[model samples]
Target: MRSLILVTASCSLLAACGNPAEEADDPIVAETPVAPTNAVDGMAGTYEVVMADGTVVSQTLRADGTYSDVAEGEVVETGSWRADGSRLCYDPEGDEPEQCFAGGQIAADGSFQTRDDQGNVVSTVRRIGDENMTTEPTA
Candidate 1:
């Protein structure tokens, strides 16, 4: 009986050690966005993003403050965005993330562009009301 009790106690201890319920998983959480300092945020109020080539693209800024990317004649991509310090940052497609305020571009019309230091526009984001702009911070 003593040996059986010891074995049971050891088994229970081992089972507890190996159990996966120790901690819960963290759900996807988005940070709050910072208001634009200049006219950038104000200008960002629901404007179409015009490429450097002058091709006007359609995107919507939702009342919920999310951003979306619209490919020509394709479906829209919804995303989330927020402020990291003073820089504007966001994640896209609920996947890879980006930021514009940190070195990001708030277009003349309140649209956000993620650009490289060389001024190459890597991504252009328009607020889609429900989706927010995505931000990728560069070095």
Candidate 2:
């Protein structure tokens, strides 16, 4: 019958427009690169960061291209650091990849700020002390 053929065609069209296997349920997010700012030389020092959840993290950025992160006086992570122009790059141990931050700014009050790949201020650093001195001070 003509009416049965029309309904069948409409059902076929609706099925064709339904969820495709190639389409993902969640949208893919792209990270936007931020413009580099401030040099990494002056940032070589110990910093204490208060995270969004009030978690305090201590980080030491050495001048010899190394860094260490301590939590509650215990070393949690150690890695190497470098400067990709004005951006600060950190390469962690094992299979973990490197992360580079842009728009780095160090304030006179010892506070610092860096932007994520999306140009958002996701990290705040405050200098707590000078670089570690390996040599024993002569009394």
Candidate 3:
């Protein structure tokens, strides 16, 4: 009958529409790799700190959170360091105040710049050796 054919056609159309919930049940999602959020991971190494005045200081950032600066083969400063988000902060072992610098991510060539509060570059730290190289050999 005409009514039976119409009902069959309507059922076919409804079935072809499919269920939204079923379609979303097994979606093919793409996974993206996450980058490191802490800048300290790449910061523990020996670097040459090139100041704005063209003075170069050899600095070492240890994995134990301590740091030391050498100028003309002498240790001029010692400090403790920490990373706050993408910023690197240093607390010197004296009357000196703590200093924090932005732009802590090192580039592919193992160099990164430190920016002051006014977004001016204060120094460029370039990695020259691994952190282990600064450590004394154990017996």
Specify the highest-TM-score model's number.
3
How do the residues 42-135 of candidate 1 rate in per-residue lDDT, one tens digit apiece?
3232334444445544444333445444446544455544434334444455445453432343334434544433556543444332224423
Clash-forming residue pairs, model 3 = none
In model 3, which runs have C-alpha deviations exceeding 4 angstroms? Answer: 1-39, 104-108, 135-139
Better of 2 and 3 by TM-score: 3
lDDT of 2 by residue, 55-112 (tens): 5666666767677666666666667766655456677766677776653433444355
Put down candidate 3 lDDT per residue, 73-101, tens digits, no spaces. Answer: 76767777776554566777877777666
Which rank order by lDDT, best down to worst? 3, 2, 1
Worst 10-residue lDDT window for candidate 3 reads 1-10
Give me candidate 2's TM-score against the actual structure. Answer: 0.60
By lDDT, is 1 or 3 better?
Answer: 3
What's the candidate order when arranged by decreasing TM-score?
3, 2, 1
What is the C-alpha local distance difference test score of each model? Answer: 0.36, 0.49, 0.54
What does each candidate score in C-alpha RMSD?
23.8, 23.7, 25.1
Give candidate 3's total backbone clashes.
0
Error of 3 at 42 (Å): 3.6
TM-scores, each model vs. reference: 0.37, 0.60, 0.64
